[model samples]
Target: MTARKEEAGPSGLASALVASGALRSDWLTTFNAVPRGMFVPDRIWPGIADGTRQNPVVDRVRDPVAWLRAVYSDIPLTTQWDDGSHSGDGLGQTPSSSSSQPHMVFSMLADLDVTDGNRVLEIGTGTGWNAGLLAHRLGGGNVVSIEFDPDVAEQAGENQRNAGLCPLVIVGDGRLGYAEGAPYDRVIATCSVGEVPRAWVAQTLAGGLIVAPWGTLYGGEAIVRLTVDGGTASGRFTRSSAFMRLRQQRPDLPRHDVYLKGREWPADGIGSTTTLSPAEVGGWLEQFAIGLQMPGAFWTVERYDDGTYTLWTYSTDTLSWASADHEPGADAFHVVQSGPRRLWDETEAAYAWWDGQGRPGFDRFGLTVDSDGERAWLDSPDHPVRCTDP
Candidate 1:
């Protein structure tokens, strides 16, 4: 192991996570027992180390200090991008794969409530840290993990072997949920899924639990914990997390210029009757609501030096919208929004409804799976439409 990784092992990481209020005594024991450095590489992106714009490339094998900080810190250490075709070797636009930060992994595992005898299936093995953790908590034979990329799966398998974890790692689509070993007690996905796959619910035994990162086509990401009831499973948002987009459902990497061309405004014009910014509105709904309403609205938030902020969202299907914190009396941003869906508006409405319910959110929400389709709320299971809107 690199000296930097050596420094972060056990004590340093334990202290950092504990102080951050993200570590519990039992969980900390698990974190300490497993060597995180074994699952990560000896080099990583040192984001804005000087508290400026420069994100220097640091080598753990070479720079012990840099390695220790990167390894121990709660921030996610990105591993691959563009489905491993493009390396994080040098910083760029896309982030394809990664070893999820320690806190996120611990949080999800804690939500799973797995035990020694539980059989687990993990989607998107990535660096295999989670699978290893599962294997450690459960047993090597009790875990099965799948990855889409052949190279990534192979690498993850090696990482698991190196870490002395014996999870049955496979290279294939995770949507199928490793049916060869059916009736898993727990299923967890590290990658973000656009929808909960039917197979996941089908394969999980009655009363099993599935904890995954789910969202809509647009971009609201949240961690969902669904408990399988008979055949269906449902739960609420345990926390908020950002993960690499699922391989099959990833959006096209659109150029900024293409979206900006010939932008049109709604006849109602910029000074419309809207109270909240698009992002704030987007966050109001579950990611599913945003995705169903706005098929491809991509958003970017930028902060300016003059203590001003700008939020921009572009869509190919719906009317694009932008709002700035300090407009300086600029004409209201015109929105030529025209569609039956009215994506953003619908998202806002859903948020309003959810908030109206005292923000019942996901914790109160439950899942019910049956012969037809899976549903989010138990009371709504009898309704014609079962799936949650995104």
Candidate 2:
């Protein structure tokens, strides 16, 4: 255990959250009762406000002040890296689990819109902070949290017990909703998913809400709040998010060598020049729109020392690939595309379409999940985005 800092306590954090409008009056009691520090482990990698980058480790035993400060801060704290396979003081290859940012946590809970006697099913227990909040608001028996990792579930259970909150922390795949606790009034996912699982809809009662971070395999992510209605669920995105992808839904992307297939740069690939700046398409909203339009594609950037980078886009099938060389202040970017699919052409077309459509932000977009599968629409379910490959 670490000594608490005077400025880095639950009261200060609660006040900050309330001032930010993240902590509503109804949920304030739970927020204050179940402190984030109680749920967080002694050691953690503190993430930035944007949730893109993470700082070095801060262990309570070595640096309690830093640890407490991180806990109370609005940013996220990465608790486990590389699915717990990583060890040491330095950062890991990937951040597997984390105590999500406070603003995001409370905002998502607010989107959940749960009431007294409402049963909640939480996906991804993580540090049990979210579950503890839910358990405190709605009785412990009314909250059920599913965790894919046994170790994480164990630790979350321990945290909940220590916090005097006992929400059922089940060790199971979150994609498969806990049917034993069927027909929950509210469902929330801490982790993001490319597609809304059918089980979640089936497990939710009619008119119940499912709030989650829904994103694309490409890059951009946003929090979507869907309302279940019979067999179909539809709702608009609430805010932008960058949560870890659900474990089962994580894509197995093809390597660069596999795309090249023993060939060198621009080997038998059609080359062209475009006025579309690669930098313009790299923005969060641009990526979201492009990802929605181009379903099976994803992108990466290869940076050079001269302040330029090559933007590479690849299809999930590993057969199609495109590269656009982006130099600073270059009017025309060089493009190369191979495979049967004209990836660069398609991406450019998608961006143009989005631009023509007023480049709508996340709030204007909505998702619908039903028997036919999921489709993202602009405003209503009638005007769905034309997905190249669904």
Task: Quantify all predictions' global Cα lDDT against the true fold.
Answer: 0.68, 0.91
Least accurate stretch of 10 residues (summed lDDT) in model 1?
A: 381-390
lDDT of 1 by residue, 198-268 (tens): 88988898888999987655666678888887766766667777787678877764554444455553333
Quote each prediction's TM-score.
0.79, 0.96
Candidate closest to the true structure, highest TM-score: 2
lDDT of 1 at 45: 61
lDDT (tens digit, per residue) of candidate 2 on 1-390: 996654877888888889999999999988878989899999898874222454878999999988989899988888998899977877777789999999999999999999999999999999999999999999899999999999999999999999999899899999999999998999999999999999999999999999999998767899999999999999999999999889999888888888998989987789999999999999888899888888789988999999999999998888889999999998999999999788888889889989999989999999999999999999888999886762
lDDT (0-100) at residue 211 of candidate 1?
91
Q: For candidate 2, list the clashing residue pairs, or say none.
A: none
Please give the clash total of every predicted structure, in order.
15, 0
Q: Which candidate is the best by lDDT?
A: 2
